[model samples]
Target: MLTDHHTHLAPDDDPLDEEALSIERIVAHVTAAMDRGLAAVAVTEHIYRFRVAKPAWAHPYWETQTQWDIDAYWEALSEAKAIGFPLLVGIECDWLPTGQEVLVEALRGRPWDLILGSIHWVDEGAVDYDLYSAFDHIDSEALWRGYVDRYARAALSGQFDVMTHADLPKSFGPLPSPATLGWAYDAIADALAAGGVCLEVSTAGLRKAARELYPSRALLERCNQRGVPIVLSSDAHAPADIARDFELAVEAAVAAGYSEVQQLKGRDRRPVPIG
Candidate 1:
């Protein structure tokens, strides 16, 4: 059996309000996933802590939404479970420098199966839509080093279930590798190891310019050596994106020397056999 480590679900309410994210659409998508033999999916909706100037790429439905109520979150998970769908409750959290309290309180008393911790913004004052733009003034080594350090903090902070993507900023920028930075990637890998953070083998990179999993092969090997676990995900933003590249990602993990991957059931992670 296969489980999608990350997915988004549209709620069914207020035809106009949820037209795009209606439950009908999400169920259709889930049905499609079942057809492909996927046993379950961890449903993660976006949770924001601050206001921002909307970007052109922002989804219209999400433009005015700022937070998700704990009640609403549980309701969605309950409904999915009632329907015999093994849905895990989770959130894609954006970490702010000062919002840890708010996140902790919001998560209090809630049984979250998986939490995808992501740094959607930098200290530069605005949320970076094109994450690669973060490396504009810095060399590749410094840029990647900074990003990885932040990831290490996020992991050690104990706020999330897994680190979403380790080196996503490169998807949007040009950088010098090995030329300007001597083995900076190794340092980043070491940070992840020290922090006890598990790396996500995201397939989304294949659809991006990088066209490879985050952390790359060498970094993954180092993570394996450090005994860090790995989980697979498509990070599916759209309904159809569920389980988009399981075969390729699993192959990549095996090549990186991981013999097993993790799956969540009722907030507990259990191992799944991998070849």
Candidate 2:
């Protein structure tokens, strides 16, 4: 059965909405996933959306997002699972160098099925958010190199189950030549393999300006060659987006020589064959 390993409870644009973490919304997301032929999905809300994660987020944009209670989010997901829904409680954690300790401490002892590591911020600027675009001032090469360096570090940190959107810098536009960045991809693959972390094949880029799947074919092949396992994700922020563009995601995986994908539960994982 196909499973979506990454998703979100809050609206990407309006994470502070009171109804974002409601049990009703959780149920709707699971229902939508089932309708899309998915056996299960993980509701991985962004870590910065919770007030407790504020210490790890220094960007002013993050200040506007630390409005929700993580306990309430966990309770809501637990309630949904208790009622027999096939959804996993998860969180999408951003990689912040200055606040790694605080972030790790805050996430301790939770029954998380999945934790998606992401690098949305390169230093202080955001790679995807138009309001604080890193691309505005930083040249493509510097921004991409900075992002990859952090991605490798995050993969080696042993803090995440899957690394989502491996090439997130392309979200706003094209990046430097992939050939020149082969060393970066190798570093990421090596780090993931050493840390026993799975790489996420996300279709979220298809919805962004990049208009492509994450971890370009070249990078995916490198990770596969390095024995880094992979998980499929849409990075969906709403019910209708669950498993969106999955056919394309699967095709990309198959092309990259992936015959299986990882399924997660309570931080443990098992491999499921890809069709």
Candidate 3:
């Protein structure tokens, strides 16, 4: 079965808000995935959108952010589960070195199927969105190195089951320089190897301006070399986007030498061969 381990049940561009997220709306995304023949999906919402998580958020948008009812969230996911929807409740948690304690505290005692770690910011800038981007003003090389190091830290944190969009450095702005790549891949390979956290192979890149897959061929190869397994996802932001461009992702995984992808049942996992 093809399982999407990482995805968001939210509209693409608006500031993160829970009122816009609902079990019925998320189930619509799941229904769309069923049309694509996907057996299941993990709807991992952004944790920063929650008000209780306000202290951990560095994004300017969070300042105006007023709603964060995680109880309502669990209620929705629980509702879907109760009704037999092929869905898993999860969150895309930002892996920040400084916010480690706060994040751990915020997520403590919560029952979630998967907590996918994301490296959305390098310092104060967002790589993908222009509103919080630091690309134009900062040194590209420095940001890249820091981003790589940040992923390593996230993997070692033991707070996440999957690392979503493992190649987020190339998500926006210009291409990262080739000079520092050797060590960067090595660092990622080593971290994932040691941490046992699966790398997320996302097709969102194909939709990005870069038009490449996350954890591009070379990085995927490094992960393979280090014996790190991968999880496939589209990082679907809308109902129509569930499993979008997934055939291309399967091709990319096979080309990178991955014969199987991971499937998560709660926090537990097993391998499913790619056909």
Candidate 4:
């Protein structure tokens, strides 16, 4: 059965963006998953956008980033769940170095079906955006090294169930040398194997500059070699985006010799065989 483990609603409360914040949108999102033949879908908004998670975010944008009362998100999610839609609640939480207890405490006893560990930023700059857009400014090899090192640490932290986008640095442009990329993948695979964290295979990269799945072929192959579990996702932010490019994601998994994909219900993970 198809399962989309990552999704979001309104990025911000833009009055112009009513469709995203409406109950109609959440229902449509669930219907989209149904249309895609999904058995389950998770509405995993960014934890940094909610005031309850503010203490966990360690970015300069903390002061200026869009902050909304998280209760509205829960209300919408619960409404969708009550309708008997196969939707589940989740959050994409950053695995920052500090205040991890705060992040955990903020989410304690919440009805989360999954907690995706993510690395959206490295230091203060966004690794996938600013660093990726201007690859010439930084040492590509050094950047790759640093990101992988931190990713390994995040996986080993035991704070998340699934590690989101293991090879996110490849999203923009300017990749590291083949040797550097190989070693980084090795490190990530080793760390994931040790931590027992499921890897997220996101289709969003197809729409990004990467023009491929979140983890490239080489990295996925590494996971396969290490027998690391994997989860499939579209990383949808709107109804129309649910299960986007999912066929391609499955094809990539097949290419990596993976025949089973992971399904998450809360922290419990089950493997669904791919046909």
List the lowest-lDDT window of 10 residues for candidate 1: 49-58
Clashes of each: 0, 0, 0, 1
TM-score of each predicted structure versus truth:
0.82, 0.96, 0.94, 0.91
Ranking by TM-score: 2, 3, 4, 1
Question: Judged by lDDT against the true structure, how good is candidate 2?
Answer: 0.85
What are the per-residue Cα lDDT tens digits for candidate 3 across 82-122? 78999888888888768667778877887788899888888
Q: How high is the CA lDDT of each candidate model? A: 0.66, 0.85, 0.80, 0.81
Give the lowest summed-lDDT range of ten residues in model 4.
Answer: 10-19
Off by over 4 Å in 3: 12-19
Summing lDDT over every window of 10 consecutive residues in candidate 3, give the lowest-scoring window. Answer: 11-20
Clashes of 2: 0
Candidate 1 pairs with clashing backbones: none
Instruction: Tell me, by TM-score, which candidate is best.
Output: 2
How many pairs of residues in model 1 come into backbone collision?
0
Sort the candidates on lDDT, descending order.
2, 4, 3, 1
The local lDDT score (0 to 100) that residue 114 gets in candidate 1 is 80
Per-residue alpha-carbon lDDT of candidate 2 for residues 104-183, written as tens digits (9 for 90 to 100): 88789887888889899888888888888888888888888898889989988889999888888777855777664786
Q: What is the lDDT of residue 171 in candidate 2?
A: 70
- Where does model 2 exceed 4 Å of error? none
Q: Give the best candidate by lDDT.
A: 2
Summarize candidate 1's per-residue lDDT along 138-196 as a digit string, tens digits.
55566665665566677777777777766676666665576433354565566666766
